[model samples]
Target: MRPVNATDRTPADLLRSALATDPARPLVTFYDDATGERVELSVATFANWVAKTANLIQNELAAEPGERVALLLPAHWQTAVWLLACSSAGVVADIAGDPSAADHVVAGPGRFEDGLACSGERIALSLAPLGRRFPQPPAGYADYAVEVPSQGDLFRPYAPVDPEAAALIVAGAELTGAEVVDRSRADAPGLDLTGPGSRLLSGLPYDTWDGLSAGLYAPLAAGGSVVLCRNLDRLGEDALAKRIESERVTATAR
Candidate 1:
């Protein structure tokens, strides 16, 4: 089996490559039009978040390789962090997945009740600006914002992640880590993410493969970045145009 490394065998590898190439470059710029909120994460900062979250998954949750983690979250930046964290920890992330069968569950405020169905460790994300913790912690659920801060800044999976092992389940398809990387590389050119400083503006949700590819994977595979927009339909054309220009977006997937 191929090893997961920075040269590109998995999504974690893509993130590592980005961090190595330009740690200061903004990797993910997120906007919540409804709340008029914006946040930007550089490659280094993003990697730190991934590392800490991966530590939380591997140590606190004790989630081993091949364990399924139900991600009941949306297209927020924290959600993206969790996606890569799962890769780093050698766990399978099931997007909008069934919680009951998962080894662990990461849920947003809206999906808190649903995550209760899971028998394993449960984590909740407030998804608030600056990753603020919940005002009051939910019963039986660890608050991600609170717990992640205490985790290690670096992560190394207890068990090596097999590039050929299952990594993601999305939109009715299961993809191994290697396959996800391969597909992302293939999708980059078509998504117009092969150019220098390619920045994609994506208003798509995270439920489907297309959304994940355009919003996160494709840009990472191409050594580019993304501007993730939530409630984008609520933004007027004028506002959207200004955002495109201000964000230096070269591609769009809505």
Candidate 2:
């Protein structure tokens, strides 16, 4: 392997950076609107969460490095933690709305129908009823949301990971068939998630690329915190500005 250098960046680099500077800082938080669940991670906990999650994925899901593990999830705390875990393991997470038929689908019961519909296998991270509950959880799927915890979890001791590589595939400014016909294609941008003072106010729908990438991956990649709201519109002009001020978020890209 080439000697690690500044140019040879990876997702693990971001985690390490956060660890060095402010390991106890708040990196990300996910709030569940339905269950009122709040999941929070500090820089150190964020790092560990990713490691354990990655280890589990590698061991159980056979998520080889660079293999795209797709997430069909709403903006839940578990989903946020999984994003961090995927990046740490160097597994490419599929956030594309147009998932191929063969992709492994992981989703919550009620909110992730599209994810479940598209996935070959399903995993539930929580025990809460997902509206029209399935007679039984999908055969190949496992309930992981409730199984994994932030501390003393089975995978929590996973070793630290490298930072430079395809931590996750980030999508930006994508247009649909009609929208593409009408608009231009910009090389989708990667928000420097691990950049300083990164915090998220995810006001977008989970299924949308911008929502998932910008709202989710951006924060996880940089070891930053995710600020979730039931609806983006809830982050109105004043509320958004106030939240930013309160959080002291830096380098917002929007």
Candidate 3:
């Protein structure tokens, strides 16, 4: 596996490096025990999602560089996509942030009322199986599932992304794109992610910096993959053990 380079100052850079090394390698494997749903994304597939979503953020939402998008979704696969999309688009992703203060907002079905507070563009994610659209589209909100499919497979930012610009707001601390990458790389060792094929199974939410690092950034920076589990506590101990064995998880972050 190729190590993250000094030129890789942002999360998007890390992703690009991974895609270059092994496009077919699994990057993220998501599980929702409550729904009995599982979705796997390879490096290429995940990059495709990031590209389309970034296009949505730029072309549809009209979000400019440095603008902030309040992310009101849970620790799901789409939320991970949005995080990378925000980076690729040069916008900031505020996890579980106040919608009223954002330039745009992305919310799940349960947060529609809160999403309505954003005066700018609003995107709603159904988070249903197969990333389905809402049966009834919420008024004033663009359905992400419907809009993303038509976006181009490639993405180019309208403006250059400054590594110094704020890229994420997690746990009340703002981090620049460079800083996020730096911290993620620094945390890899602590998480026991020691190079290629290191697999970490994480049940942590995305609300905090720690969770974000464990669930996505650390494994990514270490040239490894992640098994992200939502509603993880609902699974019985025996079931969880079986899952760990089946997924070949090397470590766990709870």
Q: Per-prediction TM-score, please?
A: 0.96, 0.63, 0.98
Measured by C-alpha RMSD in angstroms, how accurate is candidate 3?
Answer: 0.9
Could you tell me how far off, in angstroms, the CA of residue 32 lies in candidate 2 after the best superposition? 4.3
> What ranges in model 1 sit over 4 Å off?
1-6
lDDT of 3 at 178: 96
What lDDT tens digits, residue by residue, belong to model 2 across residues 1-254? 11122422444444556577678888765444555545656878767766667667766666656556667666555566676566556565555434454245566655355555554545565434332344455555666643344323334314443343344443533222222111111111244344445565665665555665555545644445566655345345886687667756553534
**Residue lDDT tens for model 1, 1-254:** 11224458989988887787789989999999888889999999999999999999999999999999999999999999999999999999999999998999999978999999999999999888878889887888999988999999989888778999999999879999999999988888888886449999999999999999998998888888999999999999998999999999998999
lDDT comparing candidate 3 with the true structure: 0.93
lDDT, each prediction: 0.91, 0.53, 0.93
Model 1 vs. true fold: TM: 0.96
Residue range 1-254, candidate 3, lDDT tens digits? 34558889999999999999889989999999889999999999999999999999999999999999999999998899999999999999999999999999999968999889999999989999899988877988989999999999999998889999999999789999999999999999999899898999999999999999999999989999999999999999999999999999999999
Candidate 2 worst ten-residue window by lDDT? 180-189
Identify the candidate with maximal TM-score.
Answer: 3
Model 3 residue runs over 4 Å out of place are: none
Q: Score candidate 1 by lDDT.
A: 0.91
* Best candidate (score: lDDT): 3
